[model samples]
Target: MTASTSHRETTTADGRLSRYPVFLRVWASQSAGAVADQLLPVAFALYAVQRGAGAGTIAVILAGRAIALVVCLLAGGILADRVSRPRILFTADVLRAATVLGALLTLNRLPLAALGIVTALSGAAEAMSRPAMRSLIPALLPTGLLERGNALVAAVQRSATLIGALVGAAIVAAIGIRAAMGLASLLFATGAVAVLGVRDSVAGARTRTGVLADAAAGVKAIRRRPWVVAVMTAVAIQLFAGTAPTMTLLPLVATEQLGGELGYGLVLAALATGALPAIALASRWRPRRPGVVGMLALSSYAALPASLALALPLPVTAICFVIGGFAVELYFVYWLSALQRQIPAEVLGKTLALDQLSAFALLPLGYALAGPAIAAFGVQPTLLAAAGLTAAASVAALLVPGVATFSDPVGTKSDPAGG
Candidate 1:
């Protein structure tokens, strides 16, 4: 069958994928890849602890990974725009597998510095794969299916994260850290195989240009599009403010108010669980003003830190997390859909990379401030400050004239100005 015919047959009459075989393959790859990605931090943390490394050493290793990610992600995006995404993904997976194998074999034998370098290299490979995989999605399915497709992928990622952590913990507890690394390698290899199964027909046409030029063109595109810039800026602010509380202080709140590590896991899982239903229902209901809906969804962030500080019952806290997850997922569907509609297929990868960079640029700063802020002001006050910042961000986005009212449905052509 022709590519279009096969895709049509797999989807419903509305161009929604009722049973997209290719999507299943793609999802499988993503799940395996996600498992491997999630395994890394857990494994690395355990390995560091076992090595008698201090918290400072662990921080340095993790920081190295983040720095490598920022450096490699843009190059990965440029490569994806200029070459086959599947090929890039496959290569990244192979590299990751090699890195993990090397880590497993040498972690016990090598110096701490050498192990840190290998871990950073693995993180770079994984970072390279992400933008390419994200850019590949618009080509795999029709425009009408993008929201559902994204939702499915997000759900798989969430599930894989939860499962991978448990599996990694079990492997470490049972076999050893080396065994956990071996499992990660196997997962990456499986993901590579799945990427090989994805047909080349879904790959976007390549742009003819050097890397710098291609990246520049992507920047120019964003510069010309006011709404894209605005949305990206808003997302960046939201992410920065939310990161401190979500990643750092939430654990403290759990430990101090709820219980401890167990409570932290429960809350995290609750957030993921909340997102599940949102993903399931995303495509079924189309928002008339997607941008506005997305902005409104940011309000949910206000609930999380405040609720935690109040020492709400465990059930109530979990429910709040569920609500927060649902809101975040809903907003994400709209945000990604907007990008798919606004950005051209040829440069989508670069644009997406830039978007990611913008959104996460402040994460390091947030992480840095979290500990000191909690130590100085205490968890409750710090959390309340985060909530206030998050709320202000939402309000700011809502007040932006075009952001709160823009909408572009699937298959509908959007005005370049994003009206």
Candidate 2:
């Protein structure tokens, strides 16, 4: 049967989720962990600044964390496919808690290098949790409700980011960064406790192959699915060309065109605000051609760069950011839902790791290059180029075979092991 017909058939009787208690507990666990993830970075940055770390040192610390996360992600994926996912989640949260509290207690007397190492460990813990978390959803919800479940998860994550940033700033201002870090540690512990209530084991069939061989199996799985490669390629391009440049330039644009930091904060808040409604829309809307619709929505992200490039008014720019945020989140919900529904359970974690790795791999390079590109080519030209590249990638993704349906009709098989 065609994918559209299959999707339509599954729509009935799955509207109301029956296994909601398990899902809710998992969601709560994820929420706590997500908030802590955001809280730590802000609190750590403030604490580092108070310790007299220069911008270069702070950049190094952030880079270390990113690198650690990237390095550990594949191992995390391999382990996730091998062990109980809930156990992985619990262990990851405990590690994060230990890392934060350990840094606070011991690293204060040492150089900031020690603190950076601790945060890098925490980032690795986060990397370990992500693929397990994403891969666990199919175990919690049936195929029909997977999209809504993913939409809700995406919404919570985005909300946690805004809440965490605001709360981190407030807590640091009120009680200091040390106290904020303590609270973040508590949050991670809370996540650890919460995830223990999730009854689903959510472990796939354990492969006896070595890590390299297992990793190669994941690559083979991806090669079997052309749509996965197509969407991931488009996402990689979007992040590298569009997202990295926009992030590098947004603050500068706000300062020059708007009124500096306050305006920058306002633009960011507006952007975040736009995603809530988009997520709500995603929960109720299930498109027949999810990949095509998602990529088209992703193309709308070009609006923000275009607005900034044209030196638009602050209100206009903020509006553009809102639209861009809305589109991106809409795309994200659908794309993630597609992954959960399409990828085989056995290799899902590895595929997710690869997807995440591809997205993060080019980000540092893009961020590093954005400044030089801006200086050499000037800001407007650079921003315009980002917009064009984002649009082009999104459109190009639609041409790949199987992308329209987001699945290969003949290649995919049922999970015999019930992973």
Candidate 3:
């Protein structure tokens, strides 16, 4: 852990989070913001389909959003270090709300180009906000509580996404997409209100360093810590091989076998259902070698694709997703907590942006490939190939000395090399 992080380990009188009321307030804001973040994707997909836009059109819109997010993350990262994180986040939230509100104005008559633009702009705003929000946590909490803090934040976000999906779906079905968009805008506004009242530590973190110099420091931090880069590379490969493939293949398989869109959604929800509980469970569990353990945990993702390739029953595939989702959440909580503790607060935002860049830059390619592979080689072979690739990636992660030996500060040597 960084020297500053060691000095700033804030805790409650009896482990009650109420000890840090400001952090809890930020978490509340984040949870509310997540509702807006989650609503747009599902809304866009639904509205596009409702308007007779085909898969290709929907793909373009989603792709536009992802690309924008990836493209803006670095800038966001830099700003978080040089500006007040809460201000950055609040501004982004307001901007995003404005974009969604504009979309709501022409909901039924929304043009594909306009939809793509709005979604991309919204993604860009989120890209700026994400690292700011993550970086803010370390400033608010201590090294010891990073895991629990991250877990609570993650759980709230997952819950928001879950609830937002259901509520957005119901609104779209019962009322209209306009109502869903209105709800998202309202959520974003609520977050702005919450964030405005937050007493921030990040204001003191802003520096007079040039943007390029600040960004370079963040890069050097990752370069100095070889383990961070190694872990990020492995995660990138894992996303390309495992997460993206399952996301693409599941819907196709569900449509063919289970029922249709409803089946596909249920399978997706099963993963979230698994993940929600895992986040809560992880709050109390701190693994010895968190970075290493997270990498190994990712291997669980191989199950879903392997199950699909075997032409398993729909229930079995959903069960596999459930298992995979738990692993995914566990890995996320550990990996993020490790980063938050290990990295210095000064460069944390930029480092996280690099992490986000690594994680996002390749997944679109996986999604792009999955469709053609399913069309040509068929769903079974495509899923089987994805499973193999995910397994290979996991094994490759173990070969990285840094990933293999990395350990937590509280500290047990789970691996022989560390001992």
Query: Best candidate per TM-score, number?
Result: 3
TM values, all candidates: 0.83, 0.84, 0.89
Instruction: Assess the local accuracy of residue 419 in candidate 1 as a C-alpha lDDT between 0 and 100.
Output: 16
Q: Judging by TM-score, tell me the better candidate of 1 and 3.
A: 3
True-vs-predicted CA distance for residue 348, candidate 1, Å: 1.2
Tell me how many clashing residue pairs each candidate has.
Answer: 0, 0, 1
lDDT string, candidate 2, 196-280, tens digits:
8565544544556788877887777777677778888888888778876776566556656787544655666567667888999
RMSD of 3: 4.2
Over 4 Å off, model 2: 1-13, 42-62, 105-119, 169-176, 202-205, 251-264, 307-314, 409-419
> Model 2 — which ten-residue stretch has the worst lDDT?
1-10
lDDT per residue for candidate 1 within 254-277, as digits (tens), equals: 556776444655666677777778
Instruction: Give stretches of model 1 more than 4 Å off.
Output: 1-20, 42-65, 109-119, 169-179, 202-204, 250-261, 307-314, 405-419
lDDT of 3 at 1: 47
Error of 2 at 236 (Å): 1.1
TM-score of 1: 0.83
What are the Cα lDDT values of the candidates?
A: 0.70, 0.76, 0.74
The number of the candidate with the highest lDDT is 2
